[model samples]
Target: MALWGGRFEKGVDAFTQEFGASLEDDKAMAQQDIRGSIAHATMLAKQGIISQEDCDAIVSGLKDISEQIADGTFEYDVNDEDIHMAVEKTLTNNIGKPGARLHTGRSRNDQVATDIRLYAKDLTRELLEGNVELRRTFIDVAEKNFGVVMPGYTHLQHAQPVLFSHHMLAYFWMFTRDYVRLTAAYEAADANPLGSAALAGTTYPLDRAYTTELLGFDHAIPNSMDAVSDRDYLLDLEYACAVSMMHLSRLCEEIVLWSSTEFGFITLSDSYSTGSSIMPQKKNPDFAELTRGKTGRVYGDLMALLTTMKSLPLAYNKDLQECKEGPADAAKTLLDCMAIASGMLSTMTVNADTMLDQAHKGFTAATDVADYLAKKGMPFREAHEVVGKLVLYCEKHNKGLEDLTADEFRSASPLFEDDIAQDLDPEGIARARTTYGGTGHDAVRAQLKEAKAALAADEAALPKAPESK
Candidate 1:
């Protein structure tokens, strides 16, 4: 018989049981469910609803079940429906009457909410740590490549020359914002909802505050109905995961582009690349491509949860059960992607020579030539037109601006002097951009220092996990 079966005369059909069971999906929350039960039983004892002896037995039985679950000795029955009922049934079987009292002043509605919140809090801490590690990897790669210049693009056309380190630091800031979102999600999940009972306050006297403290929650939920029905915390978590995955996808897209023979900016290590079954010479970035593809799965997870909660009424509903799997899958997918991407980045060989060779081929120094004329007292608009004509002439002759003589430069604009050739060098152009946050070497070093400090601060903010049992 099910835990709530006393009111029903007939057992549910097999199909119904299969459809309604959440045991497989929620088994991961067994530890959290046990922790919430222990706190609830203790609160019941403090409120005089259950005796101290009963609390002691309940806690002892729960601890034993926890150990069994951890050690793979616990037998899970399909009839149990979910981890909550499985643990409760096991407790009742072991401790008899006192185990029955463990549910006093509580309902599965509030209990499940509390369990999920606890689980979210722990997962949030984990993801925050992962984000910090990934960001550190980015910083390490950037610092190592500090002065390497690359062609900066607008609409896939070369617009300027930029330091490779500066380009990498842009991703650092994107992920740093992702860390902030994860922190906010953690705060949302930090409140205790255990004492809310089944959408209305419990009739028995209950010390909600004591349970809140025992479970390490910031506070108890203020209203039973809101507490039981709210899933905004889950939404917050999925949103964070979705946004973080988007950032990863963007990086993966760039990896795919950079590793191509056409770009030749990077080569993935053998461990991270795959060979074509038919084409012997092919080494494909399959992992990076897959990371880019899986980003849509995370977005679907977020949207699925949002749609599930859109029409529900004030209190707990069976539909909320559908919310669990999406966020769990999202979390797992993102963590795997982040770890693999970090490995790929840390191991892959950067083809600095190829990058440098291609850097100047796209006329990357054209802007510097224009800027040189603009600085020499020519109207900026006129300088831009003059450089446009000069670029046309160079293109007609299949020559670069760097191949032109100083006399040819002066013909375009007398403002161009003999030293104009120096201004056309890609490295010289990149170095002249010393403004803060620019692609200049000095600016990139300062950005790396700032990135390291940000990483350290994020590492410090993650909550320490409780000692494992």
Candidate 2:
């Protein structure tokens, strides 16, 4: 007979068992389920709800089962319905009556809820580590290309020259925010819901605080109804994943463009590149394209959980069973994407000369020219118009602003001087914007220093190793 089958006159049909069982999907949460069970058993024994002998037997049995699951030797049954039952059944068979006492003060509702929170805590830590490692890569790449000038774009047109380090630091800040979000998600999952048995508080005198400490939860859920039904932490996790994926997609998009033959700003390493099957000349940014494409699936994961929880009545519903898959998949997918992205970035080669050469074309110096005139007592708008006309003249003459002679500049405005030639240099143009947070050499250096410090602090904060079992 099934664990919950005593009330039924007959066993469920095989098709119904297969259709309703979550063992396949919930398999990943088996360790979490076992962890929660051990905590619950310890609490039950502490409160005298069960014998100490029984609690010890249950804990020992659970640890053995945990080892079996970890070693890939545990068998799963469709009749078990979910990981909770699969694990409990295995424990009961391994330790007999004592293992049967393990679920005395809990329900599948609270059990699954606790399991999900534990899983979320583990996932959040992983994502934070991945975020930190990827940010470290960004910092390394930025330092490697420090003060290298590249054209900053607006609407895909060259707007100005900026230090390549500044470009890389922009993403560093973006992912820093993602780190904060994932941390918040971790905080959200830190509460223990183990004693919120079935939706109402358990009557078994279970010590919730004992379980909280044993399981390393920050707090016990204050409300039983909220405990079993709440999945906001998972949502927070998925939202973090979605936003992080979006940022990765943006970076991947730039990588694809920068590696293109037309742009030639960077070259992806062969390890991260895939050649066209038919064209021997083609070295494709397939990894980058894959990262961009996988972003939508992460978004879909977020939306899937949101749609599942939107209208379900509290405290627990069968619909909630569908919740685990999205976050599990999202976490795995995001972790893989981050690792691949870090590899792609660390191995890629930046074409500094090509980037600087492109930076010099398309009137990139026009803004600096206007700034030059404005600084010389001309109203900025008037200076902008003068520079615009000069750009037109240079274009018609098939020359860049750098190629224009000082005589040509003198004709446009008396404000133009010998120093105007210095402003026309792309490197000089990039160096001129020394405002705080601007793309000037010193500003980029300051930013990189701050980034390195941030990376150091983040690395210091990471767990030194996996938590000791």
Clashes of 1: 0
C-alpha lDDT of residue 435 in model 1? 89
CA deviation > 4 Å runs, candidate 2 = 463-469
TM-score of 2: 0.98
* lDDT of prediction 2: 0.90
lDDT of 1: 0.89
For model 2, which pairs clash? none
After superposition, candidate 1 runs with Cα above 4 Å error: 466-469
What Cα-based lDDT does every candidate model obtain? 0.89, 0.90
Expressed as tens digits, the lDDT of each residue in 1-469 for candidate 1 is 7889999999999889989999998898999999999888877888889999998999999999999999999999978899999999989999999998888888999999998998888888889889998999899889878788888888877778888888888999999999999999999998988888899887888888888888888888898999998989989999999999999998999899999988989999999999998999999999999999999999999999999999998898999999889988898888899998999989988888777777787788887888888888888888889999999999999998889988888888778888888887778888888888888887778888888988998898888765322
C-alpha RMSD for every candidate: 1.3, 1.4
- Candidate 1 lDDT for residue 345: 89
Put down candidate 2 lDDT per residue, 1-469, tens digits, no spaces.
Answer: 6788889999988998888889888888888888888888888888998999998999899999899999999988757888888888888888899988888989999999998999899988999999999999998999989879999999999999999989988999999999989989988998999889899886788888888888888899999999999999999999999999999999999999999999999999999999887999999999999999999999999999999999999888999989999999899889999999999999999999999999999999898899889999999999999999999998899999999888899999987987788888889888978888999988888888888888888768764322313
